[model samples]
Target: MTSAKRVAIMVTCMVDQVMPEVGVAAVRLLRRAGYTVEFPAEQTCCGQPFFNSGFRAQAADLAKRSLDIFEPYDAVVLPGGSCAAMIRKEYPHLLERWPGGVARAEALAARTYELSEFLVHVAGWQPAPAAGAPRVTYHDSCHMNRLLGLGAESRALLSAAGCAIVEMHESDRCCGFGGVFSIRIPEVSNAMTQEKVRRADATGAEVLVSADPGCLMQMRGFAHQTGMRLAHLAVLLEELTR
Candidate 1:
């Protein structure tokens, strides 16, 4: 019955281009939950970058195209919270001036869910226990946590999957991966990242997990210097469950 629900995977540009493995893990997890996962080849950016850059016209155009690509699916799932939030939270606002745009964006928003949210809430998924539990800390990505209101879902799922949760200092603080914000203000961003890496390292966690690919990449930049292992939540979950 779950397979009857066709979900389109919106592989965010970062995951598609830099971290395809996270997308692979997402597919694996969705398949294990009995859903028919799909990739809409015509899909492109959700327009967050443009929107964040104050290019409303360009962002709205991309959002409209995204609506067309994902509108036919039963649900749209993406690994990054930032992009998911862009669609679920910002799409309607961005499309407000277009004809029937509000309605279309709202409809798409209603069916879109972040992967952890979809898995935990819609699919009623629970991971099988791993043979050896790893001590881990969770990073609450800004958009995913504040915009999408998803704080405990990842922790809850990880706990159920048999990970020993280590409390990272200020786990909810921003990791400075505000898409282009990092590029715009590298000094400030690097400082914040160093602080975040310090906190993650202080936890002495065997691995640090984040649901957002952006967050994973940002933290991974300092992992070598910090001696902290980093993993996307999908990858961590897939491994634990397998």
Candidate 2:
């Protein structure tokens, strides 16, 4: 078991390469919750892309590498729910063929959590309500909602932060950024994203918040059509807490 006061941050590929501010915000939030956060520099993709694309061997290789990198932490937290889901739900299956791999994967999965989950469930954090908090709508990324059953944690956190929650129609609908799925079916993906943005726009929310970077990026591509601002939940919470 790792130290209760120490946790590892797996800032996943999208956050590292695209929206690093989310990772930075995540670190701030954890520290604010009184944990000494560690970033294992060797950490990389959790192999969701490979695993999704039917590259089992490559996915397995990366999973083993991730397992090695994160095994020592008392708890692992990620800003993106998709990557967290990859580790928590898929790692054991990916490593099942390797000797004792499944057991190792299970051990790691038990300690891993998505950002809001760690904060709300583990840290028991409650933010001082923001002054003049903006009205916001939340998007529930598929892996986070369906796969991990974490639909309410983020919403609860947002409420605690003093943001007025404006529920969008079908808040749990996929933003259609299924990683490679978007590239493989741009027309369908774009259509889905457009619908999602339209719903958020209809809510008249000033900001569209999501815990998943993939959904943020995908929706952001279409954000220009509407006045709604895009933000990751971590960034929003960090700003509110400060």
RMSD of 1: 1.3
- Could you give me the TM-score of model 1 versus the true structure? 0.97
Return the TM-score for each candidate structure: 0.97, 0.98
The model with the greatest TM-score is 2
Please, what are the lDDT tens digits per residue for candidate 2 over residues 1-242? Answer: 44468999999999999999999999999999999999999998999999998999999999999999999888999998999999999999889899999999999999999999999999988888999888999998999999899969999999999999999999999997888989999999999999999999999999999999999999999999999999999999999989
Error of 2 at 194 (Å): 0.4
Clashes of each: 0, 0
